[model samples]
Target chain A: MDRKAGFLFLSALYITFFGLPAASLAAENICHQQGLEIRQAEIRATPPNAPVTGGYLHIHNHGTSMQRLTAASADFSGHTEIHQMILEAGVMKMSPLKDGIEIAAGGHIQLKPGGLHIMFMQLKQPLAPSDMHQATLTFDKCGDVPVLFKVTKTPGQSDSAGHSTGHTHQH
Target chain B: MKKIIIIAALFIVTLIGAYSLSEYIARQLYPQNTGARMQLGSPFNLTAHTGEAITEQAFQGTPSAVFFGFTHCPEVCPTTLNDLTNLRDEVTAGKKTFNIFFITVDPARDTVAALRDYIPYFGDGITGITGEEEAVYALARAWGIFWEKNNITESGYNIDHTATVFLLDDKGYFKGTIDYHESRDIALKKLERLTAIR
Candidate 1:
């Protein structure tokens, strides 16, 4: 084969094998919504027979107006709800909010351990490290933003895509 | 060469059989307790969230569900309590009699008044209890409940504890613990099975 033809052939192979897959992966990671960004989503680890598990994330408001995140859903559970973790008289108390969590323009809300977060209730089955669950976060303004939550062995461990920090130990 | 191959195949088969048999025997000798099939029985008593004294005697002739958690716990406590609320509703709809109890390990912080407000948040007829540390410890030990105080700083401390919901028959003895992550239906089914046993 001619040198020029060989070089063209190699370039075509590289694009087909590497470039296309990388582009598709990037597209899969992208959120469908324009102004909403999910940062640092994580799920807590508990024993097999435990009743409940927790999820944490950071939501940034990139739009011009304020937005309210009212509800969340995980495919693994029957339902998910937003909860606030409060310390009353030195005891940590968690309460559910009828009204959804709000993020003002240019402001961000953090869902971390020992604080406000989401609770996955009535798990259909035991969550394993190999599993990846998808959740749809519904907002008043931004509409429904579908997020793929990657299950981890513990909190603070990043999902399979390796974007955010995992669990944090409260000392 | 044929003899050698046959011998190697036989050795491999023997090794596989040995491994499978050992695993099966080990499982039989020490069965794994998934905490799913266990039934929780009750009868221990302590102070209520209303600061009123209560005893297992008060719940006599009625089945009750008991959960061991402090009010300060953010995740497990509330979620379990909420599940209990749903469980109570389901039981009532089925026309069965049942009571729910929340025993606080952090009595120092979770006062009866606090429990009164907290317990009722999930549902009505739920009782929250707190007592002296030694008394609570004694009850916890008897039930095989495990807990430890952690993150003690200059200002405060956090506790790490076992999150088990104990189920009690009308007679108030430990029947078994509800699996921590069981669905409301599965848990209700287990409760029904326990209550039906004569």
Candidate 2:
């Protein structure tokens, strides 16, 4: 083929394959919110008819000012709340935080197993293994970031990319 | 044609005989402790996370990993659960198969709902079981679990119990126990070996 024709074909392919989808994703704002960027988001699987599940992720503050994560929401649960694992007198207890989780300016906070996390309660149904679900994380500043969570039999079972759905933390 | 037919028939007979002999040898070598062996091929009858009656019988015919713990347990219980979670992940990554059960000795406090909230914090395939104090005591004793509740100076209490994970075969017979102190990789290797032993 001639150079001009080849260039036109390549440009068409790029527009069809990459540009269109990128534009749509940008319009949906599935990755970034107001000023905060969600780095890695994951959810751990729960057994059949379980009432609750755990969600983990990392939040990075790209803005100059610190921001507080007030709450989170997902279609998978009736309610979502921020919780912290605290050691009180040798007991590891998980308590819901009334105040939102805070991320320092230019810093990052990790929501992992045995640490701070998002509690998904009142599950409508059991999260079966091999099922993938979407959760929308709402920040006090970032508004909302849509994340995809893959439900596996165990936590931290995702591929090296670190994208997963459900509560997965290691001891 | 007649010779071929006869050979095929002999091959089928040999296959059946070998299977039966292997089964007999396995039984002889693993001579089950009848008194210690839980009801074979029966589902577990325990309490659910909601405090209702749950029958292991409901989940029959699947190899399951079981552990005994309490909700008030601070370190060991959660640590073991997390370990089990890690083990489960490893097994899945290797395409292995198994189920898990978390039986609570603190029946008074670890109701079905409380377990419902607590157990799933670690992983998904784990089931939490609780029951009447007497039933729990009997089950623990039958499984050779020794646990004692010690009251602290403050308000709470702690249970010092055996930290071992019991493995049940698909037939619901007790296979073995994975000790608590073992490393995760070692425990997973043992579990994989146990499951691979047909």
Candidate 3:
């Protein structure tokens, strides 16, 4: 979790909503293996033919017991799912977790944009921030990692591989 | 130990049958998902990413802000159209003249040039409605709105909507609904009570 203090706390939230400098998209956001470390892995662009896009990252875990992330894969969208965005009675719902998202043993989970996201879904093309995708998360015991996704354009712009409180683009 | 009370009574009857089948499929696909205050969102004739032909009586002499997202919905319809264009630029900072309609309940992939290249990036006054899909499903069934499209063997098969952001009035009616889980000071006090009606 000391992963460069999570990309220096997501480059101070991409200098408060895209003043840029997510440190060149979080210094080449990696997929290193140590106890699950994958930070600043963005996606967000979608609106030139939008179909679905939103994947933010930060996984930490420094290992001990609890991990789970279950699934996620990408070669530039078709279906990725993970979604959370709660709120319930006050409305704002967005469900689809289907058993994945645990973390807790040492703890760390971010995946921003309105709360725990990843949903790349069906977007065959058009997600430019000059594009650069990869995504591959699956973990129940730290197996698949993949990570790369760095196409920022607002929505928590490029933390590339680090940050925490996702308020990166509220309007 | 009687098999721990028969495995805690079969885990409380499978957690009440998965909470009454997910509360009856969330009351049959979100009956306004209970945040209530519905009714009012009819009358339509979309098409207006600039090609004109809008209606609901040009938002009838003022007070507007209808939203029923799409354009591939990459996160709660652009975070509920950037929280209704930041409560319509903090209560009409353009000296009052609100009018936020962004219709398109997926008008066959939001055409009209994809809502004129997507509602000017949540700035400006914002107006983007796409037509014909039964006139955007009769303006999304007079606003009870609830899209579906679901998992369809996956391939980006996603649609599940109802992100709310209503608040019309000025004779267009339905004077409620804010939820993007509220707060922009409760959605600018519900868009200052719908631009103080009238």
Identify the leading candidate in terms of DockQ.
3
How much is A18 displaced in model 1, in angstroms?
Answer: 43
Q: Tens digits of per-residue lDDT for model 1 on A1-171?
A: 999999999999998898865653444344324456676666754433443577778787776778898898877777577877654433345566679899888788887655788877666776655455666778886566666555554454343336434432111
Residue-by-residue lDDT tens digits, candidate 2, A85-127: 6543333456667887998888888876656878777677777
DockQ of each: 0.03, 0.02, 0.17
- The list of candidate 3 runs beyond 4 A from truth reads A1-60, A63-71, A74-107, A123-171, B1-53, B56-58, B67-69, B78-100, B104-108, B111-128, B131-185
For candidate 3, the per-residue lDDT at B7 reads: 100
lDDT of 1 by residue, B129-177 (tens): 7777777777777666767786453434446666667776676655666
**Residue B137 of model 2: what lDDT?**
73
- In angstroms, the error of model 2 at B102 is 2.8
lDDT of 3: 0.71
For residues B1-198, write the lDDT of model 3, one tens digit per residue.
Answer: 899999999999999999998888877886634343344766666679877888778776787877777877777777677667766777776466557877877788788888887888667778888888987887787667777675556354556667777776665666777776555688887787778765
RMSD to truth, every model: 22.4, 16.7, 22.9
The 10 consecutive residues of candidate 2 chain B with the worst lDDT sum are: B34-43
- Output the number of the TM-score-best candidate: 2
Model 1 per-residue lDDT at A131: 56
Instruction: Tell me the number of clashing residue pairs for each predicted model.
Output: 23, 17, 8
Model 3 TM-score (2 dp): 0.32
**TM-scores of the candidates in the order shown:** 0.47, 0.48, 0.32
Candidate 1 colliding pairs, count: 23
Judge candidate 3 at residue B116 and give its lDDT.
88
